[model samples]
Target: MIINKILNVDDYYYDVFMSISESLTGFSVNELQSTGLADIYYKHILGQIEAATFIEFLNTSKTILENSYSQDQLNNAINAEIIADPGMQDMANNIITMWYLGTWEGAYVNDLSYKEGLVWNIMHAHPPGAKQPGFKSWGVKPVNSNS
Candidate 1:
């Protein structure tokens, strides 16, 4: 109930989830948002974990972002607080997994999530079965062919 209210308060908290995710996943916000699964993963994680812990995770991430002066500081702070803290670490790892693998709790969230996995983007390849390459297009893919 409160998260619904807080989420509506701004551009999805100007997407605090995105900021936390960028710091955690080593992916820029643009890259994360580009996957089209950011919001879905956010809500998905909420469903997988306790809401209050996730919220505290968000706040801790926000504080780290606000207080840190450089990238190293940000990384250190995240590792120390968000990743190392017992309450947040599992959720942190799960978020990273969701971003990279498009799955939550070892299961794919949906076809869209699968197709849009960061793994595909990072590996510069699509899921083999995601789209028929048309037998003719099967040669070594052009470097830019991942999309």
Candidate 2:
């Protein structure tokens, strides 16, 4: 439960990850000997930080970036666009989300802003220094996907 409390701030995302990890690896607070949910939460957070760093590195090279319907949809869109697949539009949105709410830097610096959790609102938040992406879809999915 200690891990749960620590992750409380981000329960919407991390809880699901915990459930799945527990199911797959059979790791729990008792088994891991974490002090509390915070320990568990932070451990996962560290992993996510590493993954996000890798993602930021990959995204920095893009000429354009788009927004995400939700944070989870981000990776799929990016992969789709990289291959020049039809999903490029969605990927563009994900890049835009990272640029604004996330992190991205490369050959050319582009800043972006989006209202939290919406594709179109992100464009509206665009700071003066950032380039605006032109994705048509503006629908926002709820932050938590689990019931």
Point to the candidate with the largest lDDT. 1
50, model 2: CA deviation in Å? 4.9
lDDT of 1 by residue, 1-147 (tens): 766754452544447789888877889999898888877777677777776777787887788888999999988998888778776888788888888888888999878888888887777677878845466666766676756
lDDT (10s digit) by residue, model 2, range 49-134? 45454233334323212354543554444454443553433333333433224322222121212222122332344333344434
Query: What TM-score does each of the candidates earn?
Result: 0.84, 0.21
| Off by more than 4 A, model 1 | 6-14, 132-136, 141-147
* Root-mean-square deviation of Cα positions for candidate 2 versus the true structure, in angstroms: 19.9
Model 1: lowest-lDDT 10 consecutive positions: 5-14
> lDDT scores for all predictions?
0.78, 0.35
True-vs-predicted CA distance for residue 134, candidate 1, Å: 6.3
Q: Global CA lDDT of candidate 2, please?
A: 0.35
- Global Cα RMSD, each model: 3.5, 19.9
